[model samples]
Target: MSEKSENLVEIRHLKEYFNVNVGFFRSKPLKAVDDVSFSIKKGETLGLVGESGCGKTTVGRTILNLYKPTSGEIIYDGKPIKTKNDIREFRKKATMVFQDPYSSLNPRMTVSDIIAEPLDIHKMSPSKEARRERILELMGYVGLNSEHASRYAHEFSGGQRQRIGIARALAIDPEFIVCDEPVSALDVSIQAQVINMFDELQEKLGLTYLFIAHDLLVVRHISDRIAVMYLGKMVELADAKEIYDHPQHPYSKSLLSAVPVPDPKTARSNKRIVLSGDIPSPLNAPSGCPFRTRCAHATKKCAESMPELKEISSGHFAACHIL
Candidate 1:
């Protein structure tokens, strides 16, 4: 694949599969992320949205090399990350903010130590004083005060804990971060504050992000572009506003229709496109498109062969037989 200087991270045909035990001695390959491809520009946020167990988190983890990919190419900053040493080097420039803030942090560790862990592992700081300064600086960047540094993770509120997680992710001064549902565990009111903080940090630090979430409203707010995933495949990808205003795929339209509008009149008039049946299991996915079983527009062609994601318009791509 050709390298683009403007792109910070490029994922091509990325697939992650897990072995599931079905019988006493038999197992099946569960495709968590299958043949996914996309690229994030320098200092841009790509929001990944899907229902639970849609492999959204797996994509983020795979990009950061947290989960070993089954087969694919991951390019970072014009270099291909293929070997162990490359992954080790890539870790310094990439980090992840996990889904659950409460479980992501160690309860025994103080906020200072938690944030300083990355620095300690990478030996980025010259001395103890420098590490302490870095930790405090990161905390301050995320809206935490110096006094809160001594407190343990359990002592802080849900929002505060998430801030600490963000601080830890930022401690390494990473260029790219895989935010795997960072604010999902927090209260509804706290969600906006944390999301806004992410925006501010991205602007202040020039960070690139792969934000994974189930909530369309939250994703639309923080993302420049959004990619909709179903089962283990990408259904549609486009600019956030373009996807919201004119979602082309059947599944994408269904997802956008469910986003609750604030205005009562608009909400009342909006038609929700309810998808039929549950998402097919990845282990036993349909032969053609992964979403065909639940899609209203599915036809005989949709069952005959899988649809390749094609550009219907400029910068808008969708995998659908009908379109």
Candidate 2:
């Protein structure tokens, strides 16, 4: 994509922290997303992969303004997202398909009503007939049949329900979508179908995505660029092929190593870098480098100061003292 089309969503030094009460009068803040930064280009997929509590989901939520960020900036289409009105306007252009298909949907509402909800809220359609037509169009776009529209969410399988969710996201004709683990909860075969649908939808709609998932293999398959996070910080960001072939950060290397190779011969040849020790709590995260405790190349300097994300090569960034 051209540079003009390459920066659809720009996030800079974004921070989201939650205040927690410890004991009598004592309290600490939990830094869920700490100064994380990245951008998703139009028609490009930026895959975010990390451990369960590494703030990947938090990043997506904060970007969509689902959670109020403590600090930093989110600029979409050259406008800063800050005030309630700014976020309200931004919502018209952005939407999300949550991780869980079963819970994200309202079990009480029919699939048709669920998809139409956004259209009704946004007032995208002029008349009742216009709304019905738009909803059917979105359903067909996501590979759902019009016949199934009247049925409730429980009547559909995991993949089908996810399709309904995707249809709802598209109802607003959004330019951006936070696809939070859209396929993780499905069967292996169903995962492929749902993922493929997302790819197709993006192509047809010219959508930008912040695709968050723990599966490195799936992320690599769909992403144009990939960002890896450890604790609350982004450790590495690079093009998908570059990251898969040449990971720079020690934490990123470990993550790529753990993705099982399909070929038995290649899998046998690969070395798995098993990390020791558990992840530090967000309540009391380690000072300086968060990944230093598990880094084999760590030094005193690594613990003394946090490494800023610096350019390692053209379009590749990493945070490391040794690199």
Candidate 3:
């Protein structure tokens, strides 16, 4: 596909596979992210949702070049990334906010030191004074005070620790960030606070994001568009509202049906589409559709060949034989 000027990040047929040793001196390919493709416009958030182990984290890491892609192309800012130097240059503009705030940060280092690490590595700060000032500025941006800078990450609350992580991510003034379930470990109240901070930061910094999470409510709240993955493949993708209001794929419909409604009346009337059978192992995935085993609408045709993701409506895409 041709590059679009508006698209800040483009992923084409990205695949990440790991070799598992099944027996002595024997290994098999475990597909993590298989033939996934998408693009994010500048200053827009793309929410990637799927069940645990659906390759959500792998996709985020692959885009950041943390885990080398088994095969595919990653284009950032209209340029293809090919070499270590290219990745080094791209790192300046792209960063990641990891899932677990506690483990992601260095327990031994002071908060100020942790936030300043990126600046030191990239040589963004000219002198010691400049680095200190930049670290303070980043801390302030994420709602932390200079007083907290001297403390270690282990001393802070989960929310505060996440804030520090965000501060570190912003130290280099990155344009694109892959937020890999950044608030999943926090309390409900804290999750809201951190998410709001992310929104405010996005608006203030003009930052684009690939927000990966399993919570549909959180994803819907932050995403301009949403993509659903099933067993390492994208099953559906569309505007957040479009996918929620009118889900075309069976798996998408099933997932939305499970989201809890706050209203009693709505909760009582909603029908939950429960899928039978557990998710298949990626190492021994089914021949055609990975979700065929649990899909009520699955047919012989569905088992015959793998369905391609096709546009079924304006700005909506799904991979289904019935569609």
Stretches of candidate 3 off by over 4 Å are 1-3
Which ranges in model 1 have alpha carbons more than 4 Å from their true place? 1-3
TM-score of each: 0.98, 0.97, 0.99
Hey, what RMSD does candidate 3 come out at? Answer: 1.1
By TM-score: ranked, best first: 3, 1, 2
Q: How high is the CA lDDT of each candidate model?
A: 0.93, 0.92, 0.95
Error of 1 at 131 (Å): 0.9
Tell me the lDDT of candidate 1.
0.93
Task: Tell me the tens digit of each residue's lDDT in model 2 across 173-249.
Answer: 99999999888898889899888888998898899999999989889989999999999899999999999999999
Per-residue lDDT for 13-111 in model 1, tens only?
Answer: 999999999999999999999999999999999999999999999999989888899999999999999999999999999999988988999988988
| Clash numbers, per candidate | 0, 0, 0
Cα lDDT of model 3 overall?
Answer: 0.95
